[model samples]
Target chain A: MSAVEKASRPRVAIVNFGMGNLFSVRQACLRAGLEPSITSKKAELLEADGVILPGVGAFGRAMETLREQGLVSVLKDLAAAGRPFMGICLGLQLLFDESIEFGRHEGMAIFAGQVVRLEPGIGPAGRPLKIPEIGWKPLRPPSGRGWDGSLLEGLPEGAHMYFVHSFHALAAKSESVLAITPFGDMNYCAAVQQGRLFACQFHPERSGPVGLKVYENFRKMILSGR
Target chain B: MAAVRFIARLDVKGPNLVKGVHLEGLRVLGKPEDFARHYYENGIDELIFMDVVASLYGRNSLLDIIRKTSSEIFIPLSVGGGLRSIEDIRAVLAAGADKVCLNTAAIANPELVREASRCFGSSTIVVSIEAIRQPDGSYEAYTDNGRQKTGVEAVGWARRAAELGAGEIMITSVDREGTGQGYDLALTKSVASAVDIPVIACGGAGRKEHVGDAVTQGWANAVGVASLLHYNVLDVVGGTGSYEEEGNIEYLKGRRGFSHVERSSLGEIKEYLRGLGLECR
Candidate 1:
């Protein structure tokens, strides 16, 4: 823990658009052996060895805050430049073309998809499934795709993840959909991987030991410089 | 259907984690973080830390505990008790609490539920409803950890809180709490059926069968267990590591166990629930 050693560690910039708490994300990064900084400055974001977009809240409000902070294009360029990017929860929604939450709002458009609210459906017991889908769910790889060599590498097939959101993304292209999770009667995109950009609709930082592997993987990806 | 969340509830008084029958006459168990880490490692779905004496002191003292656990534990951490204002909520969230449970403040000013939800997303706001069943079979809302009674109806308050944008509701039965008998199924069902948001049933889980009843009969989306899990850990941990200058330490020093409530670990509870064909992580 010398200052020199601390500076030598990989820098992970967590985009702070002033929407939600970033403490858990920052703590997860440190536990994963990465030096994390919560910054919105374009230069700080671009200079980091890895970047994480962690958020919670309404999609339209988050986008508005990002735009107001002048971080819209900055995020797009970072994902476009392939800077080991990862998004969690609402951050995953902001990577799409647009979201219909609280009216249609533009997104960072790094991926081709539209975020829509989860359809209300009834559970097996005849009770209506709760909105926001607040609970732990296991991840299933999409057909023709695997977790191997991806952001979810080394994770088990049915690894449970913590999710808390009312809306999910609809990937236009099938190849972009990395994982799909089943609700009452619908299946929605849980995670997406296109080139260097990666995003998941679950909070890995809040998902426990199994979820911590995700941050560990991101740290390894940064150190490997791939 | 998604898996049912099995959460461990820890009632903290000063620096010690304590448990009491009817949320009174608390007996110090041990350190809060130790039990939290143990539960997290054992695959507990979530952890809730309630400051049992925060209302009496007029401030939440769980900030340090929350910060310490947020670094070591990698799961959702929710802190409650004496969160009166927006700044208090912000302070706890910034200290690494994923959600804040509001009871006294929300009951005093119902608008806090709406305002806090709007300010910090609905998902971050959880309305804690403590209820005591009346002679007429209607449940009344109680504040200050079931010490003060409000004339408001329990089920009606739940509907109102959800309408005010609360993403989740945690209904704790003051009568059933710490009794180790079972959850007040009537109280939970009425509230759960009233709101579309998730409702977590708290208190009165003596055995794994009680947990099953809470989900199957009570219709609880999640269960907040304290005595069953806490006593189980205490049996293994045996004696408090350090005597903190707060709360009652005599219970821990004597190593006297609670014979009334059956003890079970988080793993055993999840296994029993899964055996009954209920999905659990």
Candidate 2:
């Protein structure tokens, strides 16, 4: 296949470490018009055009699986090398320095931040709201830096996506933050971009057409260059 | 600031989407996947698939239905009914289901909620309750298709389930199910207030305003509808009339409540809710 055509059908390695529903992620990848191979194998990650670190459940257990499956170094290398990467929910949490959930679990430290619990009970409306913040929430309007022009390229300024998480990422540096979403007491970093590396505390696959649009834009980014 | 989720609940029996009033009467609709597509295209926020008769023999059909729906429908899907063990929950997730709603199993062993939540994250474990009202103005949680009472009061049990790590509590009012008398607002509000997790209010929605009431008055994070959507299937007289896929054509042939149902379109409902100042996509 020609380089352009080959780039158009980029293969993404969905990192699976005994956490998350890999099938749904794989399905989302396919919906984004990309080939997805759910694998824990090191060689698969090396061959793909991009990598997706999808995760759920406890941070400690997930870190254990990642270490045991021999993926920690590979992920760290990708982060340092600035490869196209995306993390969802717990995957996004795992990208930070540490998390307070189930004790202090050290993350990949790919970005500088700590994951902390959201303020529970009262929401912005002053009415009592549930934690774990389920359902669809709108992303705060992007900063002046905005998106990198591919991943969020045609997406509305304040597009909403499905989110289901108690803990959120807190960027140590404001410059690393790409998007902020409000939750009751305050607004936190909902999405961050470190060069080609992008991570979000929301599930793009579950966010309906807008979510699918996110994947489509990411797919275009992967196809734009060598 | 999350938009309230508008869910379409489809109950399956064997290979067909079945509808009943107050969780009874047994009316066949169409194929679950086809119905799911209709709602997905119409801008539904989420979907819930409950296998009305979830025995070991009937699981294959449900899995097939889910696998098909997940491929085309790119929204969050919560599947329930006959999920008993951690393996069963895993199997549902393996079939591309985003979340699993546990009613009978979670009730039998409350630890199952803890275990499943631990394995598949609390967000993926939704504790579903079929609440039947009592004479003394209390609601009892029922299992086995609401045939047997678990004696657990709706709000209290919902709190306990959330404490045990259940991510969401889906309370369906058996008393108001298919009754079109508007949601059991009192029951929904109580459970919603009791849990620290999201509460999904199901049943008793014959009007568009009832859905709005569930969010405003009932404090539900999401609203689940069945007869209002399934009974009022879109394009029954015009499109999706070919291939005779599964038993949908036959069911549609004998379809009831095509135009008689008092349900509004998904767009209309979202527009109405947004007009009411509720955030909706």
Candidate 3:
């Protein structure tokens, strides 16, 4: 295949640490018109045009799996390379330096932030809205460049996406923050994009068609050498 | 004022979408990805994709459908049908399903519910009950896609499911299914009263009033319906005609204008919930 053809059919690797929604990531990549491969293999990470880190469940367990698989160094190297890389949910949280869920656990430190619990003060319907805010919630993009310029292209601002998490990201640096969603008494960053790395607190795959467009945007970026 | 909640269900057979009466019969619709996108754009609180043939296939093909659907639509998607073991639950959750609904499996092996809850957390497990009314005026639980009678009472099964760590109980009335006669309020209230967790009333729902009835009279936290929103299926002509002769053409055109309600951001949903006096913990 020609270089352009090969590049168009980029192989997107979904890093599997046995704690993430990997199959969804793989399926999203395929729908976005790319070849998706799931691997804990370090070699696959190096060979792939783009990488995705997806997670669900606990931070401590995820860290344990990542460390056990020796993917910590591999992920760092890939991010340092500036290839198109994205993280979802705990995957996005892991891109940060650490999380305070169930105790302090160190993350990949790809981004400068800390994951903290959803503020306990705000209650919905006279009852605690509960942890892991389940179901669909809307996202508001930042002004100026907006979502279209980065990983969120083709998805409309204020579009509702699926979310299922108890903790939210508090970016250390405001410049790295790309989007914010208001929950309870706090407004926190929902998406962060620093250079080629992008992370979403919501599951784009679960977000419906608006989410699929996100994958398509990622595919376009990887193909166009962005 | 009470906040309205809507849930969209996508029935799947292999990689394709399908719908049927009860659970034995089915007709293919289209690719799940397409339907999921349509529903997300149209304003749905949550989506459910049931692998109608998962039990027979001995595996959840809904995983692949979820993977495909999730990539396109950013919405909470629940997968059901053919969940027999913890391994099956793990595979489905790992495949991008937000929650796994257990019906036949939960009835057969109640421990599986506890095991799944312990491993994946109770919030990720949902227990689905297919209930049919017997001659004695008691609703008996049926399993194996509603093909076999369990002789277990619906209310009792619902209680057991919750006790075993099922985060939510989905009660479906098989007799009232696809009939659009409104949900079986008694069935819903009985199950809801029997469980501490949220109860979702499924089966028949034909109008907006029915939605309110499910939430109020039925005492259900949520309601699940399929036929009323099938974009590809025709409406019952005066409630008559074979489903096949009705044809797979888009009906209800120009009769009702679609909602112009903008998609609320996560923050907005929180605000709305707050406005409703809900505590967002």
Candidate 4:
């Protein structure tokens, strides 16, 4: 595509799971100057220049909906095809192997991991500090990543992002971790990037300007086909 | 300065972070760690995680998210959703949450507020009231994500929440939610007037000026919005649409809402206050 055509906006799809933050995701995409479409249709998802899977509810329900929609295989196929696929919150967790929230439920299994609770024994003792950790915390990106990727570009390392969730990914391999945040005695991975798939455990849309940069960077990658 | 208190809200279901209106707008933002770090870096004063689906799920996942976030953020965190008894409150607090918010559970068992305050102190207890404007022009309290009407008056609930030892009352208007129309000033003022403790006005914010309005006109301590800020609709981009445009971008900018203007004014006031060798507070 020529520069003029390259400047043409890409059609982005923000996957709707019937239980996620579609507005915020859609709004963020629009602010990034990308025309965003919300859909659960597999064909629409596969047709997009890039796909964003955003969720904010239960793990099992999200999985069930994805399975019902038959999106599980398409998303995995898209990722395997090196198409840029991003997952936010539950969307990210759903990329894991499974979750132990209420019971064992299979995930997309795109990444090698399981979603597990942040056990109380690992943190400060007053009470078992509430589950679903909310608010902002600092993010430490992986060393020497050079901040040039589709995500975390134009954003400084150690920048904080908004988060609200009860469980986190227990990655089967440590290399999948793109960033880490210190919580109590444990340091948990914040962003995980494996191949063309990018997943974050925080709400970039809600993280203000610094967070907006992440979305913009993602848009740039989608446009550049990088 | 009172540190301009900030409260972070985490709406969750099962193990995922969910956002929506009356359980819509469903999309996950990010992982618990990403959100926690972002808010901490942005200088949030306090954080709140409400499991919008907790009651239906019969479990509070805010505790798990809180424990993970608190370990990373090192800021005050509050957890809510499906919180029914003192044990639930205790479990959340122990998980690293500094406060616990009560909605349906507190309404069902008003004594839970008192019990929570006794064990965790009033400062750590918050009462969240979801209100929707009725066709009669009065606001009715709703429970279960506005699914059930309680016929409880908004003002009455504010007073009751305070009396029941709630340190703060968070009032969210369903009608104005995600609309960016500006907060319901009249309703906010009534609730603020009814309670001595801090009152947070949530919903219908599209700009920084809305924050000031919520604080000044609504007499609220804070304002909450998920759409405008989350979407970057704010005029962070300083530009008037080009000469090709019919009018100046400045006019188009302010048309979104007045809260942005109010916030800018507040910033100026704070700066002026500093220059005058006086505290903004």
Candidate 5:
């Protein structure tokens, strides 16, 4: 709670639009040596040196809550301002232009993409692939790309991170795709980076040490003012 | 296949972390938070804290423990035992549990699984089925920590739960639990094959090979281990914090170990799994 008052450290606002637990996100920030404030106020989010949009819930419900809180435009403006902005899990889905979950829903349109469910299919090993790919999966860089200047800089290739979700983002602009994770017979866009905005479909806060490095990278980005 | 998840499951009785054989006669080990932190520091993929006495006592007391753990350890945390309603599930998720495992409530009211999954996404809801083998070679679902039988077939219940909207299924064998005889491979394979959702095999993992066997042979997507990891770290992570309750101080005081359960660290288990070419985080 006192983390927000520390003016000497870089401030990171964890956007709370009534999704789910923000404590783990805040804790991860503190461990990363960044001051995190869990707030919904527009002024607090706009004033932070960096912002993290973390969520866990349905895509429709989360977008509805953000619209109700009048935070849809606030998020768009934060992305426009080019601050170190990030999203996790459902937060990553909300960055897309629209989501086909439950029903057709509009996202913040930060990126040109659509959120879609992981269709049930067959695994390469001749087993039925499960929906809601809920476990640890290694992240692979897109073709001809690697984690050099992105938030995943220090992480080794194929570093496993915890993921728990049923839907994933399909960016229309393939160049924005930072990482892809293999599940069953297909690979999904697991992380993306565009300008100052970085988002991932995995919960780094719940992913232990390999995950903590992600926060550390975010902190470094904030400190460098990049 | 994705990397197999290795979860450290700690059963809690009152304020102290407890372990039992066949889910009964729970002996207090230490504070749940202590064990949770230790596991987190040691690279556990996930953590499950089940309030073992919550259903019998009609109350859940894992919120504070979860709040404390979530503030430090960064890993997926699943909580079970005594979650009977949407509000109960919501309260725990709000308190920092990423997923809520429903057993007694899901069986008594199958609609609860649908309602909860609808309210809080299917991935957030996990249906925990505690199974005990019967005379006819069928696994029967038991409630209240294996103290009450629901007369429902375990494999059938797992399929029904998934159909009703459970994103994951955790099948724990009451017979193999705490006995260190290895997991009930038959029970685990039956439920895993019955549902397309991820299945976590729990109970009776006494060796690293057992952990490997659960995935390679039993077809489990994950494994929930207790004594194999808990008894191995008590000496390093010491805590009897704020537990004035009776029967909570004897086990740690004596430093006695389990003969049935083998001592192994989380790192060792993962290493052993990797040696088998089984991908584990």
Candidate 6:
């Protein structure tokens, strides 16, 4: 990028946890008109204006990679300082207290919740809602007076976002829940907005135009009042 | 509040978009990115990219295209065609694919479905069944562009595939492919009702209503289209229609129930269905 472009762009570090595809996250950042860098370096992360934890695959492996890369303590520090951290999919699950996937795995504990398997049941139509509920589902925006969309500020009320997860988070406090998505007859927490930390259980980078708006909102949220 | 998905399926050869009759008589359309951009701008719910020649040529050919498209197009991208091993799946996913569709490999090694699902999570693996109708009215799954036949029945195998941890089933009717007569409602309904997971019905979609038929009558969670969606886009020089053509934009808008100019639009399928009360992206 040219000096002018680089100088003007907002640098967002896509944390290299080594589990998911960080390319798409960088792409989304670029689409949202921001400068993105995928790195595990503490200095680079600390220097950047923001951090995004893009994840896929298993949660235990992701946390292990984070620990191996020495990203756990750095991320904990960044998150503790409210450094505008965001997570996606398994990254979202990793923000919780713990999980019981292949085995019991402890998480970053930024959010009070436990990741658990989606209960077996039928959807509204009576057809069985299969596990790993793949494809797009609408987001049920938060209703409380102060629990607004926040990072999800610009998305439509019921905007459909792509999701691919078998385990869902059950937040300890309801106010932390930013949005919910239908998994069968019941709904699961789709996103959480705790302090400066914002994360979703879907691939916003892969959810088309509205999904782009999410990154745009995140950039705006991070850049404002800074 | 998740609505039904209307997807655009593009079969690629090298860097170019290509489509065949009955999945044969392959004809080059244009750059995969052009059509992908057009579809995305027109509000396509998702995209499926199949490297039609990966088995004949090499899987490497699609990596560049997928990398470029995944970087530009911000939507769910499902890549298929010659994916076999876990390494191949890893390479494709690394190249920016959200899900990898498996056909021949999954059939050749049923354990692959279990292993991939177990490793990457079931949501990332899509098992495609190209079904051919038998004289006895039962449907059988075929692989390798329908050149090879798997004796397993479509409905029963879909259930087995799901049980083996296949998260989603993309059932394409080989008999109806490229025909555009309409989706094989019976075949689609059978496989869709059989598996609890989301089903992507491909093949035989000529009219906009065919998409509707797939959801209402066939119970498919989503409809995948190629012929009816891409046939008219590329002009004589194998390029996407000249940008001067405002018809597709108008048609796309009109389908969203907007009042405006009238003309031939590529996404009429979604437009028509959107008017019929099916929530479309």
Best by lDDT: 1
Q: Write the per-residue lDDT of candidate 3 for residues A4-35, one digit (tens) a residue.
A: 86667789998887764465667767777888
lDDT of 6 by residue, A1-226 (tens): 7887775577999988666667788888998988888888999999988889888788888888888888888988998898888888888999899999889999999899899998657554444565666678888765662334488876667788888777889999888899987665567899998788899998888888888888888877777738
Superposed by TM-score, candidate 2 places the C-alpha of residue A222 at a distance from the truth, in angstroms, of 2.0
Against the reference, the lDDT scores of all candidates come to: 0.88, 0.83, 0.73, 0.68, 0.87, 0.80
* lDDT of model 6, residue A189: 91
Q: Write the number of the candidate with greater TM-score, choosing between 2 and 4.
A: 2
Q: Whole-model lDDT for model 5 versus the true structure?
A: 0.87
Q: Model 5: clashing residue pairs? A: none
Write one digit per residue (lDDT tens) for candidate 5, span B1-281: 66889889999887778888999887888888888888888888888989886742333357888878888888889999898888888888777788889999899999999999888778888999999999989999999889898889999999999999999999999999999999999899888889889999999999989998898778888899999988888888755565567345666777866788779988888888888877776
The DockQ-based CAPRI class assigned to model 5 is medium
Question: Of the candidates numbered 2 and 3, which has the greater DockQ value?
Answer: 2
Query: Measured with DockQ on alpha carbons, how good is candidate 2?
Result: 0.76
Best TM-score among the predictions, by candidate number? 1
Q: Which regions of candidate 1 deviate over 4 angstroms?
A: A1-8, B55-60
Model 2 chain B worst lDDT run, 10 consecutive residues: B237-246
Better of 4 and 6 by TM-score: 6
The parts of candidate 3 lying over 4 Å away from their true place are A119-130, A142-145, A223-226, B1-6, B10-55, B58-77, B87-98, B118-124, B131-168, B173-176, B184-199, B212-222, B235-281
Cα lDDT tens digits, model 6, B126-230, are: 999999999999999998788788898988989889999888899999888887678999998898788767888998887777888888788788889876767
The digit string of per-residue lDDT tens for model 5 on A39-120 reads 9999998889999999988888899988988999988988888889999999999999999988899998989989998887
Displacement of residue A200 (Cα, Å) in model 2 is 0.9
| Candidate 2 per-residue lDDT over residues B53-103, each given as its tens digit | 885335457888888899888889999999899888888888889999999
**Poorest 10 consecutive residues by lDDT, candidate 6 chain B:** B255-264
RMSD of each: 1.8, 2.5, 7.1, 15.4, 2.6, 5.6
lDDT of 4 by residue, A1-226 (tens): 5666546667888887776435556666766777789998988998899999987667887889888889889998998897877888788899998999889999888889889886533222221232335446678765655546648876676676777666899888877888887666677878898766899998777666677777787777776774
lDDT of 2: 0.83
The deviation in Å at residue A47 for candidate 6 is 3.0
Question: Residue A9 in model 3: shift from native, Å?
Answer: 3.4
What local lDDT score does residue B176 receive in model 4, on the 0 to 100 scale? 73
Two-chain DockQ for model 6: 0.55
What is the C-alpha lDDT profile of model 2 across A68-151, one tens digit per residue?
A: 999999988976776788888899999999999878989999888899987676753454678878888787645566664747
Candidates ranked by lDDT: 1, 5, 2, 6, 3, 4
Q: Point out where model 5 deviates above 4 Å.
A: A1-7, B55-60, B238-244, B248-253
